[model samples]
Target: MRREFKLPDVGEGLTEAEIVRWLVKPGDQVKVKQNVVEIETAKSIVELPIPWDGVVAALMADEGQTVDVGLPIIAVDTAEPGVPAGGAAGTAVGTAAGAAPGEAIKALADDMVPRPPAEGAVEPGAHGSPAPKEERQAVLVGYGVKTGATKRRPRKAPAPPAAAPAAPAIPAAPVANPSRVEVTAHPVPARVAVLAKPPVRKLAKDLGVDLAAVTGTGPEGSITREDVRAAAEIVAQPEPRPARVAAPAGAEERVPVKGVRRMTAQAMVGSAFTAPHVTEFLQVDVTETMNAVARLRAMPDFADVKVSPLLLVARAVVTAARRHPMINSSWDEEAQEIVVKHYVNLGIAAATPRGLVVPNVKNAHELSLPELARSLGELAETARAGRTQPAEMAGGTITITNVGVFGVDAGTPILNPGEAAILAFGQVRDMPWVVGGELAVRKVTTLALSFDHRIVDGELGSLFLRDVGAMLEDPLRMLAWS
Candidate 1:
């Protein structure tokens, strides 16, 4: 028997996904719950696992192809090794021996054709007693199965392939360039295959690095991300050029908008226009907070985790939000009401290769300082690797964008959709200030708070900003407020 596997809705009400890569190919045997393909949805990259044990008969879709939620993407043959597809009773050899040429070929093809599994029998070993059809299947990370009809965007026709160049004749003498000599003296090296993992290959493709030209340093001569980055750096160097140069045709490259970048663009545009933004700025002397971070880093509790100024800033935000509940809230236009949240899902904006993603720590106000630091570190690492789940980015009550990491001072930030406020932390610098009528050098930083004017008035916004600044100015204030 042959079974066709349709793409399930991998949560977040997504209609379609792009096939990033296929882990298995035709003729490869795959077991139940084994990941067979990696797909990129609007939110993040997800791996889809096969639900049955079978040999891969065919891949219905190509890598990089956009497939709808209910479309079949792969076919698997579930019959025993010696038995013909469809069953022994409808064996292709038996039917061919007695039927006409056309009829025999049609019979064999029919036997090999894939059929969708019965309703409620999507999982392996579930045919005996089918589960409820509406029940969710845990096939993809952070998502469940949702069956629905979706329209697939028409794919553009591929451009015609360019003609291959003629092979170069081998040189009889040694070449001047050592790299060219190896190519001319020996042809075997040229034919050597480029070895790299799927993720490494994806990195090389994104960086526009030619893997054939890169020398791999990994075990067994496989390329690594560091190698790709090094090659990209070398390729990025500028060469000497004439002062005046003629413009060339088609100098620009067009990148298709999709995935995380597409979703981020849409969300940002909606937030900027829908929310009436009011920004407030404050300068604070954070010398005490800086010293506290250093002391925390040396303490046993924080020895294993990273301690930075951002940690204290995050703590201050959470503490201030508690003091002023209205600051951590949202505007409900439909209900014409203000919704103030009791718990804080503190969002930390992180810039990743894909784009800007804010994965917050759930219930941050309830966590200890050390726990918050650990969560923040893990969140950063996960975002950098492009593994943050959609759930982690949802339900954020307030956000903090640390522009300081980029060596930026400060700027008015747009509020995250559904959230009432966002805080921007700037780079800290040493500045001369007057304390007790005496001028002294102090560690100073700027904070920009942008809030929904409709939800928080000017006075309330100012008070919230003042409280956060005070907490940072004196770390002891956080304890008193708590």
Candidate 2:
């Protein structure tokens, strides 16, 4: 018995993923929980395994196709048919996440027919011209499409054989007699004939437009959409953007959407739309934090780790979140509940080719300052190196994005979806400050915190921001408060 597998929604809010590659093709034997393909999600590459052991029967979807979650990509011939049809196999096949979605995503497959050696190049798949129906295989099972109306789909046709193709043209009867009297027979097309290629002719026929009667603007006086849509119901399509680099005359190029690039695009779009975000900014005098960082560099325990302004800011945000637990939660719309987390899985936002991924350090509150600095270094390295895995990027409780590394002061930021708040840390620079009634240099930085308005109210938001700022302004406050 063959069971088709559709792409599953691997995460809570994902709608789609790009299939990067197929590890197994038709006729290969696979085992349950053995990888069949790798799918690239927005943040990481995940390998999808076969749900049951069987011979690989069919693969639907071509490589590089972007499919909506729950669409099938492959079919597994699970043992024998009398076994009650994989009765225990259920829907668990669609929900597991373990491998990176890789190179080419699965899409509709193309089957081949026996061809003579003299024929030219064959097209890749089903999207190509139609061949004889009998040459095709049994319908593919894993794609999300239901088994209905596939007969309506047209396959591109092979060109007619040259030896027996040409037909005699039928001549139209004369429209005017020799006496100059109008003797109508079959009406002649308008004096200016609409000259168009076969595709344009097909378009005109489908739209119920007469090529003979419409005005032509195309070269060779061909009629177009403005000539068609203006004449009928046909709408012109916008041309796609040109490729960045021109392809070599006949070389095929494959784009791999796996790894960091895919992951980043997914996170940005999720962060942008789901949460109703409101970002508030506060500039702080962080002269004390700078001194503390310098003092920490002098310490024996902290000597190895690279210290930056973000190190102190991370500690401050975590300290402040502890003081304000409401800022560390998700707004559950369906349940109508506000979830407050008792533990902190602090997400540090890292920008990579995969976009903005906040792979958090789990149980950050459990780590000491030197430990936190080490975790931050490892997190940055893992992120920059494009090796952060699926589990690390998932389940972030609260997030902090350091836009300061880019040299910008501050701006509004959106909250990562599900999390109640996200903080943006800006660059610390020397600025004028009043100290003991005298103008002096101070280490200054800006803080921007965006929260889900539905979860963190204005008072709570202000207090969270104020405490984080207070801690940064006086690093000693973190020790005192802890």
The candidate that achieves the highest TM-score relative to the unseen native structure: 1
Tens digits of lDDT, candidate 1, 322-412: 9999999999999999999999999999988778898899999999999999999999999999888888998999999999888888999
For 1-482, candidate 2 gives per-residue lDDT tens digits of: 76768776555445567777899987999987898887776666677777788987666655776765555577677766633433543322222111123311321211112222212222324322322222222233333333221244444665664774444444375545545544335644423323453445666886777877677785435555467756664334345556788779768767765445655555557768778788899999998888888888899998889888788888888888889999998988799999999889889988876566778999998899999999999999988876676688778888888888899899787776679898988888889988899999888989999998888889999999999999888788899987
Off by over 4 Å in 2: 1-38, 47-275
lDDT of 2: 0.71
Estimated TM-score per prediction? 0.67, 0.56
Model 1's lDDT to the true fold? 0.80
> How many steric overlaps are in each model, in order?
0, 42
Worst 10 residues of 2 by lDDT: 103-112
